[model samples]
Target chain A: MNLDELYQTVILDHAQRPRNYGELPQATAFAEGNNPSCGDEVTVYVKLDANGEKIEDIKFKGAGCAISQASTSLMTVKLKGKTVAEASKFEKTFHDMMTAVTLPEYPQGFGDLQILEGVRKFPQRVKCATLGWNALKQALGGNSSHDPVTSENE
Target chain B: MINAEQLRNDFPILHQQVNGRPLVYLDNAATTQKPLSVIETLDHYYRKDNSNVHRGLHELSNRATEAYEHARRRTAQFINAASADEIVFTRGTTEGINLVANSWAFDNLKPGDEILLTEVEHHSNLVPWQLLAQRKGLKLRFVPALANGESLDLAALDSLLAPPVKLFAFVHISNTLGLINDAKQFCALAKSRGITTLIDAAQSSGHRPLDVRDLDCDFLVFSGHKMAGPTGIGILYGRAELLEKMSPWHGGGEMIAAANYESSTYKPAPHKFEAGTPNIADAIGLGAAMDYLDKIGRDNIAKHDMELAAYAYEKLSQLDFLRILGPKTNRAGLITFVMDGVHAHDVVEIANTYGVALRGGHHCNQPLMKKLGTPASARASFYLYNTKTEVDRLAEVLHKIKEYFTR
Candidate 1:
């Protein structure tokens, strides 16, 4: 319930002045992700390596809440050098951590996504927190129609 | 004057607190709170008359049929439609727009034909036209808003109504801006050019007194949730002739007079448009909502909302960071603004912390927000039961929220 769990310094730093918060020059993969419930949005880009195994670069360009953008910013940091397979796992972990969906790939340090766990409690902002990861999964060939409008988290 | 204390008693849910403060629900633009009359109507239907409406033989089904037909009649009266047959029960205004776009516009629109819309149109109004135009190879035209944001440029609209312009779409009031556009004058002008018109009354129906006959629109759409009714039901008022001419959007049971393998004929007007079993309970509930509104006298509700909105506008304008969007020349019950150096969501979160339930986002009008040169906005929408005291709490909490974020 305390802001401590939700606003860890790292998430705050990324959210306050987000890094790589713009579109890229030769975007590898692009997908539109939305939180239709709250109207939050995020477009994730990951320039994958030759094998599409590792992320060479990542960026986002869209308007979203702190949790969403911060989560995207954090994923952009944590996802570097991670294979598409690894990202699928990280995504599973992050998804489970955020939505309690119990997916196989859900990651640890949900506390890393902690600023957003307040989202799980609020139920409304879960979309805001997960917009980025959902977008990331879409770019990594998980699924294409990543519309958050009908997403259960929203 | 609205009976604040007495009126507040009917809404059992509004009395609760949020975060740590008394709930100040100013999101009527998004959805209005249901009154006990409407709630009771839903309960009464489910408890007693829960059956498939229309063409039923059993007593329960017959009662349901009567109540459902009675709601159609009541809604017809609510909008002053020529007949109950002209009123179609839809899911909400969004569904209504999609219905019209698919049913009417699909048949009528052609390549190079332009559908004219205004800047203040909501996504429900704007997106359907966009889809129709995209699907039919039609061009979408828009009349730009003036600097003050009070209304669209009538002269520009006149110019835009050239031969290619087949339909004109717009909102009676901007949900984000609170500008009540001059619908009669505008729609009349569009009609002179032989243009069909659709008005998104989602924001206006509950906030303003409406006379669809007087407005003379080919179609008018409003949601039940935004007008003290259940969420799943909305009313789409179309001229009987227009309704007769249009095809059905969704094809299913209950909309046809007869169904056989070789060939099937559809029913006329409202029945044709309403294809499934329909939201019978919600439709009955909507009837109850209209009855509640009639008892209230919409003029009185409009006046109450207008006064509170004006007062909220003035109070919020006193702060430099708080800038209300759109025209201030007197609107129905919406006030959108930005807090300096703060994101709208942040402001919304802080306000949530204080138990003030205002809305924050593009409010389903991202293009309008872009026109206003803002990413998103915070909106505090007023409704029937809301009072000046709640407005004061909104103002106080907004300041406290700004401080919370800035500090």
Candidate 2:
């Protein structure tokens, strides 16, 4: 019922000064995702290791609500150095953490992506949390030149 | 011209505080909130006259039927159609268009026959025809927008007009662009070519005065909720003879005259199309809504909305980097725009911070969005209850947004 609770300090910190806040100029793998329902959009640029399996660098740039931008900030930080396989697994793990009847056990040693647990109370912003992860899967899927296309996950 | 400040008092929702500020709702294009009268009508219907119609001889059912049928007659006369029998109630404008495209276009259109539509049609209008064209093997032709220097060619419409042009299904006022088609010019042209025109009056009916008999448009459709009426009810008007010719869109109890094993004769026109139990309460509510509009005067309401739209367009256009993406002429009661370097979602969120409610995004018009080369826009539309002050507040929000983002 509290709007203040929805915009907690953790969410605002990531929103005001997002972690991976700029474009990677040398990003060979890129994908742009847009929420057709609300017009929230984010384009992710990922510099992959030469094999295009592990993320070397990742960043996002777009305009949206505070929740959306911060969620993207949190998502990208979770994505760096993650293998394509691990990035895909993190997609399911992130969703479980956000909207479960019971919270999924957070994996140890993973950093600030856990902050997105705030989004579980606000179900509407799940699109914001997943926007970056969707782009990562597309980039690593070897269709890096293509804009992010809708899949079963989208 | 209507006392907009006084008019705002009747809407309970508009008077409320949002984020410690007055709720300046300008999102009529998306959904207009319920007026007190409309809300009361809903409560009254359920509390008193709740029953099935036409079959029950009981007092409640009888009154409910009378109110429901009264709405049918009002909807018919609101558009100046010949009679109530011609009005077919559907779920909304999307279903209404699909019914026309499938039952009429699919049946009548053959290969090489052209179905003409404007470039700015809502996806509801555009998509049904797209699917119909594909399925029926008919040529779906578009009257692409007249872009300055983008096309030195004559309006493709004039050249596209041919004898085999079977139908002209286009919006009376475009949902996104707010372009009010000159019914005389466009309808006259389509009539001359023997094109059976279906005007999507979804935008025009409440915002402007429309006369189907006067416009000479063969088919017209408008949704209820757009005009301060209840949702889940829409009007589809077809010429009486044409209604006689076209088959029913759905079939069930009320639509049928008699049913045996494998053989059934359907009831005439409107009833035949209206399958199952109708939105009886909302139908009555639409009648109340029309009565409310008539009390204010439709012509006066129309003029008032146009005045607000023109004012909003002028003031909003003058702001730095604010672009109104619609007709420059006297438009319908809305201005779809985008501020420079600020996305529409951000604009909506920032505007919400200022207690201004508006619509953002492509507004269900993907083809038009692609034509304009933008993903989405922020729309501050007006209605009878909207004011120049709200427009001024909108301009202030954009000014503050430019400050918020750039400075």
Candidate 3:
């Protein structure tokens, strides 16, 4: 249970400069996630293709800790060009890895997300890593309420 | 100044270690760690004087009633209330403020009457009034603080209290920013206008000696947990005449004189406010806490607290990227800050690896956070038990966090 494991180099780099971070201009779906205890809020936005099956673009806008912000940026990279069903599966795998004690098998395109596996050692911080992914799940599922999806509530 | 090293030993919880390091507790503004004296008092009460007060006519009841009533007197003396009758034991500061909002304001306030509050109120002081205003169609106005979200702008208070201001409720100290308000001046201004005032002393009551009479406020409320006492016990000090005029906030066995099927005659001021069985053991423990504080002398405690805060401030301010909240001078015993590229929760998460406990959030003042334009900040509060060495550890942990994030 090393501190370096939880705050690896890749996570810090992504948090410093998040990718595809901002509101997507009127395309598909949006939802917010929060770790209420720490005041970390992450709002995720998704834009689907013509058939509404493939995610054309994804963005997020909010303020939060490093783990949440980084996970959100990395989620956009994994989600773009993927079908909605595949994105949901990736989200499930990510959530499972975060909460799982033993190292779970990483799904496809989950290479970068393996950095977040360290969050499982720290139970309280598991939510910080999963906050953005939860919002992504809600957005792709077409839940429009931006009332903040908390890990505790789920 | 008080001897923090010696005092730390009295608090048994502080003797332990966290994360393989000596625990550094900087969350006193959230709740203070209790001394052995207070703990022993609680243990003794439950073991020996366990009985229902004001109901049983037996020997244990007599002892329990005496101890409980004695606690009220002790609390009144500690706060310099006019009398023990004015000290009503409540669940905590939240319940005390809610009691006032429900019993006093509900009975006296009109539809268009306004209640003036400051921007730095904790949720306990803010939400109860918001609920009341919504229900009764009352107007609620706020006196915005200075740009730093620390102290109130006294100049703006005059304008905000222009007309129809029924009551002014403000915190004696901003819990999030550690800014001490000029409660005496605020209460005097409200008094001159013939408006009532209530001071939320949840933060001030523990670190300093509070004389309600000197403050000249009609009502003052504070929690025991924040002041080295047990939880589930607090005191609401109201003027005797005002308490007599206000309606009872709760109803049950001990608060009534005569109960009928439809109508009942309620008891006097404090009794009427305290319904059912109170937190009798905690109240007794609070009395012991009062005695402990008296022995240390609050003036010394206040000096010690301020010195620690100043040390932490000076040390943490050395970090160029850190933005510390609150005014530099006349601050209470805490420091809230946010790093340039790191979030507060991340700072707290990293600090935990070094055995530091900091509060990272809005501190239940979400509206104030929005007003200050800071989404969140990490707060490290101090008390008599905290040492300058702990402040150094905090600074070191913070430096490591900054390095970790920036690297």
CA lDDT, every model vs. true structure: 0.80, 0.78, 0.89
Stretches > 4 Å off in candidate 3: A34-37, A99-109, A144-148, A152-154
- How high is the TM-score of chain A in each model? 0.80, 0.81, 0.93
Pick by lDDT: 1 or 3, better one: 3
Better of 1 and 2 by lDDT: 1
The better candidate by TM-score, 2 or 3, is 3
Pick the TM-score winner. 3
Sort the candidates on lDDT, descending order: 3, 1, 2
Q: Candidate 3, TM-score vs. the true structure?
A: 0.96
lDDT of 2 at A103: 79
Q: Candidate 1's residue-wise lDDT over A32-128, tens digit each?
A: 7776444467888788878768888888877656666777888877776777787787777776766774433325533354345555665666667
User: Scoring only the second chain, what is candidate 1's TM-score?
Assistant: 0.98
* CAPRI category for model 1: acceptable
TM-scores for candidates 1 onward, in order: 0.85, 0.88, 0.96
In the range A66-130, model 3's lDDT, one tens digit per residue, is 88888889888878899999998888888888775566677777788788888788787788888
Ranking by DockQ, best first? 3, 2, 1
Judged by lDDT, which candidate is best? 3
Model 2, residue pairs in steric clash:
none
For candidate 1, the share of real interface contacts preserved is 0.23
**Model 1 over residues B100-166: C-alpha lDDT tens digits?**
9999999988899989888778888888888787778999888898874666787898799877898
